[model samples]
Target: MLGIQNLSLFIASGLLLNVIPGPDSLLIMARSATQGWRAGSAAALGVGAGTMMHVLAAAAGLSALLATSAAAFAIVKWVGAAYIVYVGIALLRSKPGKAAAPAALPPQPYRRIFLQGFLTNVLNPKVAIFFLAFVPQFISADAPSKPLALVVLGCVFNFNGMLWCHALAVFTAFASQRMRLKPRVTAWLSRLTGGLFIGLGLKLALSKPN
Candidate 1:
């Protein structure tokens, strides 16, 4: 309606993409499993908020700078990678309590969890690039306002993403509860997720601008 074309295709593609595992999904799942649905929801909301930033940046043509400027891209990439690795290390270092599974790792405040998810999503330069590359494809060249069209499409994408993210968080939490995970197992999960994060960070660090 907003001079957008192939909107159905865009929605379908966005939903599929949201299902794929990544840092965002990992964060939601980990938080849900370790803490509860509330923590996971906080993470999901944070990620959604970050997506809006990319949408705004894409509409303003700021994302183009990351696409074209090597210096800008590299600086952001390094910083993001470092942050991801740091979070991973923190998870790895978390100690499990001898008495209780819930005590394996202390519950993080919702605000902190939200901020973590937000930073993780927003700091990734690739997300900005993706918005620039992907969203514009559906915008008509002769649209009333290309920037406005981008914003509308970006909102649609983010809305669908939030649905999937929140679903993932709730489901993961439910399953973890059902399993009645032991303290040692909970600690193991934390370490495993931590290792995965470290791997992802290294991969991001070595990534070349696409």
Candidate 2:
């Protein structure tokens, strides 16, 4: 079992990572601001799925391959990047006057939005790399049962990531209300969100692994 000191650090680190405005944060914010809370929540779920993938990969010795193989890393990275860009294009092309807000989408059995959110994270190889880089800080390479330690660390990270997603879903929902009445503003925000995702994907494509 993970110790208290490590648990505190794990939580703290997760909180910090969650707050950081990476692809996951931007993706969630973009969808939420553009569509409605449901859509945003859907996107949040997508991001959560992505985080879960990372945690599982880290636990299953996938992170070792991520750390060791450039080709594999690049493959996942580009694929993730392409997926983000693809999503962005779809958002940009979205029927401006159509589509309920992200909030509305979530409560009405909106499996499509949920799946969109889920796929976004699942395709991102960067999440795996991030876990490979991040989880090790607290892990002892020399510690007994390195694989088990990695798994525990991965679980902690996943939990923290979920907590962050929950917070975003709630906090952004409040702001989303103000956004809903103004259709013009909402549409513009959606466009911006789409652009953000595309930009992130482009950057990810170009980034060299550290």
Candidate 3:
């Protein structure tokens, strides 16, 4: 168990970020609504996977390396940015039509869905570097269990991320049902999401390193 203070802060941060709409959350909503639970969950898994990568990199000291080294940071940033842009384009080309619903869609291969989740997280350099930077501030710089504490912090982040995204996926699933009756809205929303992803990628690509 985390120290009371750490747990409290972790929950607070998670809840705050969870509520704020972002690319990952939006992607889950868009995919889940259109592709049903499986697809939405696939996106959710992606986010979680991305989270794991950040935590792992932080644990492995990659984040710290990137932090002090400008070239390394830029490399991560560009790679991550490009990946997001690629996903956004793929989504745009993917049919906006409701191909399946929770009830109507065939059971998605859970293993693959889970793997997709892992990959999504793994490919996101922003999340990776962000986690690298974010965790240390909360930990005591001189703590004996700094590495252990970081691992715990990463776990907290992953759990919170998954829980929040899953909740959104459920919400989006219902919303998708309602939207099936309104194809125009779905189409417009899909375009908006695609645009958002691309914009975010571009912004991230150009953003100065911390």
Candidate 4:
């Protein structure tokens, strides 16, 4: 178990990190704004699940390979960037319908949304590298159960992330209800989201390994 001092500090740092808007937050907001609460919630869960994979990989020392190998990092980074750009393009191409039509329009399959969210997090090498660097700060090299400690810490981080994401989903969903009534406004929002995604993809693509 983590000592009280470490646990408290980790929680505080995690919350602060989660509050700062990032690609994950943008994805959740976009999904909620465009597709409503269900899609957004699915996205949040997907992101958490993907993050768990990185946490486990970090615990198992797999992320070290990624961190050390330029080829590995580039491959994952490009794939992630491409995928994000693809999604952005798809969003841009979508025809705007009446705001009132969303209710009548069938909801996107939860599985599809979930997968989109999952892939979004999993493909980002930045996330893998983040875990590789961030999780160990709280761990002691002398700890008897280092892997267990990392897992526990990762769980706490993911739990905190889930709460923040869910809250974002709910708030956006509420705002979207009114926004959806305005076709022009909805169209513009979609365009803005699409543009943001493309920008994120470009930024990710251009990032250098630390």
lDDT of each: 0.91, 0.70, 0.69, 0.82
Q: What lDDT score goes with residue 89 in model 4?
A: 76
- Per residue, candidate 2 scores C-alpha lDDT tens digits across 1-210 of 432236677778788877888667766666555455666677777677767777778778786796688988788888889988997786666544534433312232446666766777777776777777777777764667656776777767766776777677667766877645455555566667778889989998997767
TM-score of 3: 0.82
Whole-structure CA lDDT of model 2: 0.70
Name the candidate that leads on lDDT: 1
TM-score of each: 0.97, 0.83, 0.82, 0.92
Query: Which residues of candidate 2, in runs, are more than 4 Å off?
Result: 1-5, 98-109, 179-181
Clash-forming residue pairs, model 3: 45-117, 46-117, 49-121, 50-121
The CA lDDT at 46 in model 2 is: 67
Sliding window of 10 residues with minimal summed lDDT for model 4: 98-107
lDDT of 4 by residue, 59-160 (tens): 898888889999998999999999988877766665666655653223578888888889889999898888888888888777778778888889999999
Candidate 1 vs candidate 3: the lDDT winner is: 1
For model 3, residues 1-210, the per-residue Cα lDDT tens digits are: 332236678678867866887667766776676567667877787678778777877888887787788888788778767866875776566543443422222234666555545554565566666777767777775666777788888888788878888888888887767755455456666667777888887887887655
Count of clashes in candidate 2: 13
Compute the lDDT of residue 88 as modeled in candidate 3: 70
Which prediction has the highest TM-score against the true structure? 1
Q: Which is the better candidate, 1 or 3, if ranked by TM-score?
A: 1
Backbone atom clashes (below 3 Å) for every candidate: 0, 13, 4, 0
